[model samples]
Each structure stands twice: as structure tokens, then as C-alpha cells.
Target: MQQCYGSIIRRQQHLIRCLSTKMQSFSMSGLEVDAVSVLRSLAPALDPNKHKGQAGKIAVLGGCREYTGAPYFTAISALKIGADLSHVICTKDAAPVIKSYSPELIVHPLLEESYNVRDEDKQSISTRVLAEVDKWLERFDCLVIGPGLGRDPFLLDCVSEIMKHARRSNVPMVIDGDGLFLVTNCLELVSGYPLAVLTPNINEYKRLVQKVLNCDVNDQDGPQQLLSLANSIGGVTILRKGHSDYISDGKEVKSVSIYGSPRRCGGQGDILSGSVAVFLAWARQLASKGEHNTNPAMLGCIAGSALMRKAASVAFEDKKRSTLTTDIIECLGRSLEDICPVH
Candidate 1:
């Protein structure tokens, strides 16, 4: 019995050593992704033969009465960055407000809040909402969830169903803002879904690490912890937003360190989620044609981060300390043009 216990202890120590070594390997500085090359490579050629929607069609599932600007920022950013069609599916109350923000967006007032729906109507309303979204689900190239989406119980339940449907259809999804809230609570929705990307800010990332890893955030080994977190969720890619965005999809880690403005604006993250959705859609398109070998999520993340930083810099150059999210959005087009010219 003594000998057996000793052997077991030895095996446990060996396992710990192996895990430590693996973590150390991942702790090394992340590889610097070539944002410009990836952008140019994944960018679809401007062809006259392509129809209006051929470039990309993105759907943003967010927006509530209290916060309409977030989804608006996300959806509009997609269009500004060259996506041909952008759609916003928000609550009935938020629909008009979001629509008022931009006529270019196709806004659908489909989601329902808890205050409006009685208990008995929950099932039927949820079903009807899903059915309505189903008609357009297959047409979208990507979905961005959780912009100004308030933390309404009934509404989140509906969004959860929508996420499941998106997964069933194998559609790519970028979860941010309130979307991260839903995903963290119901991790099963994205577990093992490589097509899903989670963009979490500092606070959001901390919560994610605590919930997923059963511990506090460990910045000392951020890349390794992020790797573990992504792998823990079945290889879903996570883009940890910060001074330098770190990206990991369980296979590798990359960072985008380009200098952005010091303004620390509020809607910047919404822009990133929207930008990522479009770039990811483009990356997936190129990959389908055998144009690139890396995962579309990584390319999308790197490109989106690079573009956001460049736009921020451009906006700051003009607005100085008074820069706003709208200012950054305005610069997205010019930054893309400078990065990849028509000629």
C-alpha cells in the first residue's frame, strides 16, 4: 500500500511538471500578426460583376430602449468598412431609435423585453421571434451579438435561442458587450464552436477568467491563461481588448500593439465588434476559396484591431482630446483606404 501511494504521488508530480512546462511555453510573447498583409489578402476584390449584397451582409442582435447607440455603432461600422448590407435586430422600443440613427441599416423590431411580456406569452413570443429571425438567418454572412443589449431576462433568453440557431446553421458569430454577458452565463452556447469569437474588455475578461478558470485573472501569464481559457471552451477564439489586443484560438496567440488614441471612448468596443464581424466574414470568404490557412477568427481580430487603432489615431489627429465614438467611426473609411488603396 505504501509503495502504491508513492507511485501515485510521483505520477501526479510528473503531470504537474508537464502542465507547468506547457503553460510556460504559451507565456512567451505572442507573435505579432501582420495586420496590413492579412487585411489586403482577405479583402475581396472590387468587382463590378458582384451584386450589392455579395460583399458581405452582417446582422447585429442588440439594442434596447436604454441603449440604442451600441448596436447602431456596430451595424453602421460594418457598412462603413465596406460591408454591402448591414442589419439590426433589436427590441421594438429600440427599433425606431436605432433606425433614426441610420437609414442605411435594415432594422427589425423583433426582440421582446420582460416588462412587456407576461409569463404565458413567453413561449409563444419566443417562438415567433425565432421564426421571424429564421427567415433571414441563412442569408447573413456573420452575426454580432450584445451591443446595447440591456440585461433583460426574457430578452436574453430570446437571444440565447437565436445564438443556438446561428450555431446550428454554422454561421460565424462575434460576441461582445452584453453579448459577452449572455455567453459567460451560458457557455454551452459557444463551447466547441470554433466559429464563435468572444471580444471581452478588461472587466469582461476578468469575469470570464474567474468563471471559466475558477480563479482570478492572471496577467502575469495572460497569453497562457487566455490559451487555457479558449481551449477550455472547446477552442473558441477570444480577443482580449486592452492597450494591445491579445488573440488566441487555442492553436496560437497573437497581439496587435499599434498605438490608438488615449481618449478611451465608450463606443470604441462596439466598433471593434462590428469591424471584426465584417473582417471575419471576408476572411472566411477568402478561406473558402483557399486563399489563407490561418483561422478566420484570428485574421478578423488582427485586422479589426489594426483598423480600430488606425481610425482612432486618425480621429485623434483631428479631434484631439475631444474625440468621440462617432469621430472614430468617421475615420474608419479613410483608414481602410489608406491601408488598401483602390489602385
Candidate 2:
């Protein structure tokens, strides 16, 4: 492991040098990482000999009767990025809708809302839900929390239990949307877990700052505040989504300022969460084999952010004002090809 990390550190230095020499003669905010290089290094080579589930198995833990598109967007995003399987665990009413969205996804209608369950059954239902999730827990490479996850009290409690189990099992998670809501209230859930990644947008970022740091979001020294935020949570990665997505794992801050679209679509963050899950999986797989030894969480954020931005740009050029989140997702393959083409 030491030798592997040594080689990776040297390679990272080389990439940084290249970023300075090859790119334009202008200074960029934060450390401008060579995101394309990182993506290429992490993405596995295609091999016909590899069987099913060798690539990745991703699960999205969100979706309710009121909202099903969020989970569908996330799960399909993983499949489009070359994951082997995509599973969505949602409420009973949400399962059929999410399944109807795509036959490719494995929909489990197992979660319960407050209106559907009695107080006497909350404990047993929560236990049963956790059990069902546990049966397939170790099989997944990553779990994306809070896509269409509503703010129901009982449902949130069950999801909290699921998060705890995932932590115990050492499964990585990308928390977004309402998952941030759950984590904001209970920081201990991801306080020291290195594998937990928080993808907080503008509003979510504000709430985290207030709750975790006891201060407001400081735009004047954005990277510094971001560093403090991540460190405050004990080094879990934070991918602060914005015009220039800034990533920090409590040590250093890296920014990917690639121009995306002006259209701020709703499901774009879902796409990013799914993308990060796959890239993080690939990075960790390599690390397990002593291939590369940096923080997979940060690499995953950088690569995922870069790819999503590129795809958004392409989609905007093609569709202009009509560019939606779905359009951006449709361009994921082409954007990746633009970065690192297959031979």
C-alpha cells in the first residue's frame, strides 16, 4: 500500500505540472486539478472477459409517492455511465412509478411513509426495512441517498436506520437533497466516515455551514470555508456544486470550473450523485488492488463534476434553452468520449 500510494502521489505531481504547462497562461481559483486525466486514470478498460456485476452495482435510496423522478434520474444515470446494475428502494407507491420510468432499474417498493404505517409498527417496519436492505447491502458499490426522498418523519427515521447500517457495513454513500436534511440533524451518522460524500447545493451548503460550522457560508474565502466545513465533519468529502464546483476532503481544495449550462435544471444534481458513485467505486476498486492510493472520494467528485459539466455544455449547445436534465444525461457518454475515447 505504501508503494502504491508513493507512485500515485508522484503521478499526481506530474499531472499538476502538466496542468500548469499545458493549459492557458492564466491563474485559476483554488488548485485547478486535471480532471480529465483523473477520469481517464480511474475509468476501467473494457474487457469482454469480465462478467456481470464486475463493473458496479449502485443503489439509490430515495423516492416517495409525491416524487419518483428523482430516484429514476439517479439510477438510470448510473447505468448510462456503465454500471452493471442500478437498484432503487422507494415507497410502495413510488416503486411502480420509478420502475415504469425504466425497466433497466431494479425497483424495491419497501419503504413506508407515516401515513401508511401505525406507531405500533414503526419499530418492526423499520427493522424489516433494514433487513431487506441488508440482504443486498454488501453487493452494492455505492448508495446515493436523497433524490426524491421527501421530508416525512417516519420515512426519514427508516432512512436514518439504513444509513447507520450502511456505515456499519462500510458501504460508501453520496448524500444529496433530503439526505442532507437527515445528516444535518444527525452529524454523527457521517461524522468520521471517510467514504461519506455530501453533495450539497447552494441552499444545502448554507444549512451545513450554519449547523456544522456555526457560521454563514463565506463566499469571499470560499475554499477556506469549504475546507473548514469538511474538516468539521471529520474529513468526509464535500462536493460544493456551483458555477465552479469546489471539492474538499478536509485537506486540500480543488476546483473544476469547466463551463456547463446556464439553465439550472432540477435533476442535474441527481445525475452528478450517480456519476460520482460509479467513479468513486472505480477509484476504490483500483485502490483495493494497490493501483492508486489517493482519496477515491475526492477523485470521484472531481471526475463526476467535470463529466457532468461537459455533458451539460454539449447539451446546451445542441438544445439551447430547451436543455433539460435528461438532455444533459443523454450527453454523458459523448462527454466522456470527448475526454477519454475508447480505442
Candidate 3:
């Protein structure tokens, strides 16, 4: 009788343990958000009394001879999304073309590529480039680095210096395109900085995994790997761009799978970067005011990804197979109004 009673107690304890574990898992899943709530929490109410630059001041650090459209897409998207000001810092050869894309953008034709600068003058030219960027760096709410940034050695070097300066001033950075290339190579530029966000597409994510984690991309355990990667980089947030975007800031992983378009246009990522920059600035503003609980970078990524997907969907509905990046950009304001009206 005693033996049977003991056995029953043991089984009861084991069942309780199993139930507790299951309950913990349920709790964790509950903490995972719908993402739209995050967007709503971060988006500020538009007040007519608000002054210029209150919405945001965004800067794009890219554009070169081979790639002018990318920086233009990024800068203009920020404006279309209601940023008070948008600036683009690009190579002189690319400035006029990007400027012509929109007169609203402040295009700085100060950056120089390897082909344009003599080897002996590289150091002095780089210094001048950094000086020009430094003057306006502090005024920027967020900097979007590497949209359409060519892999020019001299230009990359200058960007590295600019990133260092941005970090020192505690300005948040949204790194994409060739900026990912620069960060992947150095790692020191953004490692451990919570304010830094890396938005990497399939190939870029793979390279980042290989470079930082020193292993191949594991799709099955992608969330875990991404969590590890973000932790490995010292809490810097990463938005792994894919059919479904996964975001991590070392502590938790969240996926934003809402409202993505079927179109795979080239400049959408650029749009995402710019959008992320604006939202991040707003999120940071909220954080500084002690209003929100989530990590600002994570919130920025969620809102930016959700907004971009909605815009893409709206654009695709209108243009179908002919939908281009510009068409999608043209729909940003309307999409935002549909979700959270600005009145």
C-alpha cells in the first residue's frame, strides 16, 4: 500500500512539472506581439502646433556614380512618409542626378570615390569628406547608411569614419545595402551598439551570419540563430529581411509577416531603410520621454517593415506586374493614412 501511494505521488509530481512547462511555453507565445500594436504605440500624433524637424530629420549616406537611384529612393521615401527634412550625402558624380530626382532633398556632393581621387590625395580628401559630414551629423535624428553605396574603397573608408562619429554622438543608425558590407568587414563600427539596426536581405543576412557567427545560415533554427547573432553583436538590433522579416535585439525575437507584396523590386529595401530611420527617430523620442516598453530599434523595425509591406501591397494592386519602386513610394502616404490617419 505504501509503495503504491509513493508511486502515485511521483506520477502526480511529474504531471505537474509537464503542465508547468507547457504553461511557460504558452506564456512566452502570448508575449509575442501582433506588431501593429507596436506600430501604433510608436507613431506619434500629428499636431498642427508641431514645428518643422519635429517629425524627423533623416540622412542618407550613399549614392555613387553607378548607383544614384537607390539613395534617391531612400531619401524621398522618408519625405513622403512625413519626415520634416531629408538629406543625402553622396559622391560628387552622383549628386546632380540624385538632386534632380527631387529638389526637397539636401544633396551634399562631397564624397569621393577611388577613381576620382588620386592615391596621394586620398587621406586629405577623406578628411575633407568627414569634415563635411560631421558638420550636419549631430542634427540628424537617424542616418541611413549604404543605400546604393558602391564598393569604392575610398568612399567606404570615409563612411567608416562617419559611422564612428555617429556612434560617438549616440545617433541611431540604420545600416543597409553596401553599409552592411562595411559593417560585416569591420564589425567594430556597430558591434554592441543597441541603437544600431542592420537590415539585411537573403544574401546579406547569409554573409553576416557567416562573418559574425562563423557558420552557414540555418533556416530551421533561424530565430534562434538571429537571437544569437544579435546578442553576439552586443545587443545591436538586426532585421533579417526575407519573405517574412525576423527582428531581434539579443533578448527576444519577433517576426513581422504582415501585408507583404509579391513584387520583388530592387529599391524596396532602400525604402525600408529610410522608413526605419524615420520610425526609429520617433521611437527614440518616445523612449526618451519614458512612454514605451519595447526596445526602440525593434519597434522601429516592426513599424517600418509593416508600413513598407502595406505600401508594396497598395502599389502592386494598382500596377500589378508593372509595379516599380517609385509606384510603391508614391503610395506611402496613403497607406499610412489608411492604417493610422494623420488628422
Model 3: residues >4 Å from true position, as ranges? Answer: 1-32
Alpha-carbon error at 156 in model 1, in Å? 0.5
What tens-digit string does per-residue lDDT give for candidate 2 at 1-343? 9999999999999999988765543545337798989999988999999999999999999999899998988999899888999999999989988988889999999999999999998999999998999999989999999999999999999899899999999899999999999999999999999999999999999999999999898997898899999999999999999988999999989999876889897899999999999999998999999998899999999998988889999999999989999998899999888888888
Model 3 local distance difference test score: 0.92
Every model's TM-score: 0.91, 0.92, 0.91
lDDT of 1 by residue, 1-343 (tens): 9999999999999999999887755543336677777788877889989999989999999999899999999999999999999999999999999999889999999999999999999999999999999999999999999999999999999999999999999999999999999999999999999999999999999999999999999888787899999999999999999877899998888888775888897999999999999999999998898988899998999999999999999999999989999999999999999999877
CA deviation > 4 Å runs, candidate 1 = 1-30
Score each candidate by Cα lDDT: 0.93, 0.92, 0.92
Please provide, for model 3 over 228-342, each residue's C-alpha lDDT reduced to its tens digit, 9 standing for 90 to 100.
9999999999999988888999999988777878999799999999999989999999989999867899999989998998999999999999999999999999988888876
Worst 10 residues of 3 by lDDT: 24-33
The residue pairs in collision within model 3 are none
- For TM-score, candidate 1 versus 3, the one ahead is 1
